[model samples]
Target: MLGAALVAKKASELGLQVKPWVKTSLAPGSGVVTKYLLKSGLQKYFDQQGDLDETVASAIAENDIVAAAVLSGNRNFEGRVHPLTRANYLASPPLVVAYALAGTVDIDFDKEPIGTGKDGKSVVQSSVLPDMFKSTYESITKGNPTWNELSVPDSKLYSWDPNSTYIHDPPYFKGMTMDPPGAKRVKDAYCLLNFGDSITTDHISPAGSIHKDSPAANTFLSVGWIRKDFNSYGSRRGNDEVMARGTFANIRIVNKLLNGEVGPKTVHIPTGEKLYVFDAATRYKADGHDTIVLAGAEYGSGSSRDWAAKGPMLLGVKAVIAKSFERIHRSNLVGMGIVPLCFKAGEDADTLGLTGHERYTIDLPSSISEIKPGQDVTVTTDNGKSFTCTVRFDTEVELEYFNHGGILHYVIRNLSKQ
Candidate 1:
């Protein structure tokens, strides 16, 4: 809904007519609470723009394809899916607008486009990503915006406070009662990981259904959280304590060439053997070893839930390496102070032999300072194998976010000082 609303507002500012379609289970007049808390004044923001047209509403009520294409097209609705599965596909005004304008979500200031403007003149397409990002930064820096400005108005829809401590908060160094003594160096010596294909955020940090009888559930249960409260893994994002214990808990993770009975790899500190992914993460944390994740194409491809990045950071994952990234999750990783590095073409995760068990060390300050687009960095694995892989961060803006420990901290510190 918020995505739709924002798109509608942006479209109106651009002098475009928008008729959004939303799908919900509100039963016409049910008062549902949502995690998104839009400022009451923002209602005027929508009202001043315009209202849904009768024709558009009628079309939405009558057509399913039109509604779905519009509402789910924008990445904003992608984040809200798991929590609102049954109600998501229903048509509503706000959602329709969001989907219709998904193409404009982030304009790239550097790219040329394939079309002419409405005026029939030559139209140079400015990149929306950089432009909107700069606008947001300027707004925040000028004290006209807050993290809350980016949040939606539905509270009960999911877990965690996007305005406060979403999963991305941890890597930015929030909620850690005591900073580890060597954290400064860990921050300095950051590694850039380059990954390969089909790497979902679920592989980086699973955030779907979890088995209640699993170790993660057991950990939560031991801490007095009940079965019902265990809920979906996505719901526990706010609590770092829970998330850290549950990284890489995907029930269907396949790590190696080995075929049958393969569970996600874990580190068992007691026996020093890699057991399952979640267990290894838990054990690694207990043993004070800092870890990070790296992957290939479509990194963080599933849901836009911030926990996919947050859970790993809380588990001592200092950074992530990938060949490419999905838009929102990349920002979320940066928001949490976890470095996300993309590989240059042809230098990827499989080529680097990242088994998720390799003791990888990074010489960040020097390496990152010299990083350029399509450049590779040398990595020394735990077994002493040395190879060069591509670095992920391609822009100065991204590097600035990494230096400031994530977007929120950067926003907060700049705004506070201002």
Candidate 2:
């Protein structure tokens, strides 16, 4: 609100207008913020330039022109704002307005004028927000009319709506036993997907707008959801059914199995049929075959998304062999009971001459209980290839998490004991 007010004041003083080509938007995080902006008399400035209360319509560039998104938010990681926005910058709220007025990121704010004055004079760019905390949060629990109209179950356990696509009872704890399922070997595993360096959580589990032809979108459509009603993958994350289907569903994912083509596709080994990543995993699960992922350096790099690890586990991926693993994501994998393995230094899939088509067997030297953290494990391929990888169980607690089949499983078993 302060930044918007400053930009409005500065623009008026300098007699400059926002560029015609710039698409502006103001998405305040909450309704109380809108009230504050309105009370401060700064909402009109935002409304005049951008839609005050609407979805952010990201600029879609044409003719291969690179697009950018400058925002006041903290994160500007790849694929966080929009898939089309390759270049992203995190700036102060005032700087965001300044850049929007400039209409391009390639500028030295120290030297460049944000815009020209009304008399063609060049100008260089350089408030207390209302506080309604007590009154605004008074009705926090008292929801609006639409929320009040819905019926809620009056039970200890949640009554999951089977027909609802937004949320579902996840299958993680279904048929769980009190005793922990000690770590099992990943035997005769097929490579689910092969990827290069810097594979982010966004690629593994996208949080963006779902493509109309994606598996998640198809699942929603099959249940009678219209195209416009299919919200983003982030919005429907509570439903494991949709999230499992949406795993590895990023449109820009580059699977080496696709022969240099960029898409969320993989090859089913036995039939050699090209299918969506989730479809292939489903078939492999039906056939009772374990699956693993092969990736290059810095696997699961961006955004420590829990779904990045959970979605792979739901897809029946038993293990991931990458050149390296992101710190938080590596722990997340162990928490989800997915084994993380790192190749020996200076060795990778390309160097080992192992194509993604080969069947893989990961040999733990002993039972999972006896396996020490960070111990070396051997991996063998059906095509006469063998190599060693360091099991990425960094701590004894993490090893125990894997031993119990997951952190949730361990927690549940311990709770049942008490």
Candidate 3:
């Protein structure tokens, strides 16, 4: 709610009209925060006359883009993205509204454009973002304000109960036996990869249209969902059953050397047979064999969607040996109990001559304390080819998330218990 109000306030101040779709009830903190900000003269530039929905609808009608500024942890507006929006840039709320009003990502601070205000005045876009952030931060952190005083009630905010049955629980291993030392080694090592550049999260977990005639569409159809019922991949994230099937379903993917088989890359070991990406994954999982994914630089870029990591977890990918990783995806990988190992300096998927044929083993323990960032882990294939890669757990927070099995699990165990 604070985020919404901030966007509304920013839009009004910039003379850009807003029409908000009030999806959830506004919380007391939102009203309190907004009213306090307004009383403190932070929102004085924004006009206070319009209704939220009307402003949002008007803005959407008038503008070419409809972007959402959502927090990563909040699930309230999870399924809000529609087919109409051209580009959905997800970031913190202030950034979303600022980017929307500016109408472009390439905003030049030195020569910013000015929008005409309703009061027959010129308003500069440059002043909108920085000022709002500064004031909002100060009001929320330093100023002690009540929700009722600000006209925001608790009933207006969306409520997310951590105990909700819809959320998946972390995997439990109450009576499982641990693998004995040296028993986890694999003989054949095949590097399943492609020579590519700039593999963003959109490529990993596409947010665009899913054609019903495609391989992924056929899989969905096989599972009883009709073409029209096939929603965007982003909408079906909560269900791992659907996510695993849909991961790597992006049509733009081209496994150049894999006999032109696109989408997810598939490789057969020993017999040297080939199959669809997901089918191969299912085969490996069925045989109780571990798998790894090798890729070029910037392997996971774009939106901070957690499903990118979760999809690989469901597919039985033990690790992603990438030349580089985007910030959020790296954390998301660890959150899902997957190892994200980076190639040694000046070495990559291409240099190693990985043929995606070797069986691989990751010695990650189910326990968190046993793993440390920057530790060298050995990788050996069936043909006796071996290499040691450095493990990275860059932050303590990431380690904690990994230790607890993921963010959702951590939240449920900590906050929900209270």
Candidate 4:
């Protein structure tokens, strides 16, 4: 915090300011911290950078040009910050100010000036107290007016509002059964998506802004919600209808099925129709056909977002066949009852001579008890091509979870027996 104050002081003295293109703002931890900064006579300097509400209101418009975000926070993963910020960097608070002033990360403070001086010439140059803390701590337990004003119902069992678009009961266990359904193979499955290397969870999951015409946004609009009122996929996660329609909906996804075109689109194998990934998956489900994803190495590499797994399961993805898988996401796929398979070493879709336009069949054991972790499974394509994949169960517990259709079903059935 002191670093930010010093930067502000130095920038003011040099007549340098944050770039207008760069969105500048401060989200301090609490009002008390702001109060202390105010008491220290540094708030005025901070205000010069426009630390207000509007700058952080919503994500910037999507563009082909690369955008970046430098933050003092630790979670600087790919899509965690904002959809438009393709690259995220971690820096000290003062360094954040430096980058913000420069409006770009491509600079060296040792030789380059952060910004041009007031005369439009390039230049190169490079907090808390404890006293009022007691009073702030006294009221910390009581939330602010908005939080306190929330009307929570008083009941043992929570009432689910059927009309709510924000929060609704998920359908994971809607038709669950106590008895296991014994293992079955995925036969005649269509390739829903064909992806290449480094396909992160960000690419697989629904995230960031809800596009104006996205399926999630349409679902909201159908129920009387306006475009601006449709919060992000992260906010509407409680509603399965919205999330299921958003699977594989990343704006930047590159499906090989589209032949180098970007965005969340795929070829519906049966009809040769180019549809959104979710729309293709829905049509496959309606036609009583299971679907599988084909991908290259390091698939599911980014954040271990549960929605990445949950959304695929809801989309009727029976299996995912890739050259390799990220450890946590592999486990998550099993927990959601979607089989994760890896191609044999040195073999991928490119080498196996298989295009994504083939009908696939995964030959699994007849019963759950016969399946073992890391066992070799045979996958065949309709074009007379076949390959071997390593089943990614990894443990007996995971096998049981898949046997019961998902981890939630496994837990619920066990609890009922008790």
Q: How large is the C-alpha RMSD of every model relative to the true structure?
A: 14.5, 4.8, 11.1, 5.3
**Cα-based TM-score, every candidate:** 0.51, 0.85, 0.54, 0.85
- What does the lDDT read for residue 141 in candidate 4? 94
Better of 3 and 4 by lDDT: 4
The global C-alpha lDDT for each of the candidates, from Candidate 1 onward, is: 0.50, 0.82, 0.56, 0.82
Q: Deviation in angstroms for 222 in model 4? A: 3.7
Model 1, which residues run further than 4 Å from truth? 1-196, 202-210, 223-226, 257-276, 352-357, 366-375
User: What clash count goes with each model?
Assistant: 45, 0, 28, 2
For residues 1-418, what per-residue lDDT tens digits would candidate 3 score against the true structure?
2344455554576667533342222223444445545544545433333323546645654663344433323332212233223343456554444454554556763577334323211122322345565666677655565653555447864453454322333333223223211112332324444535566665666354455554556766886777667765656555455566666656446564475654455556544566656666777778766777777788787777766777777777767877788888888887776668887888875677665555565555545666666677777666666777776677766667666655555665666457
Off by over 4 Å in 2: 5-25, 30-32, 47-65, 109-112, 116-131, 137-152
How does candidate 2 score on lDDT? Answer: 0.82
Error of 2 at 322 (Å): 1.4
Assess the local accuracy of residue 381 in candidate 4 as a C-alpha lDDT between 0 and 100. Answer: 83
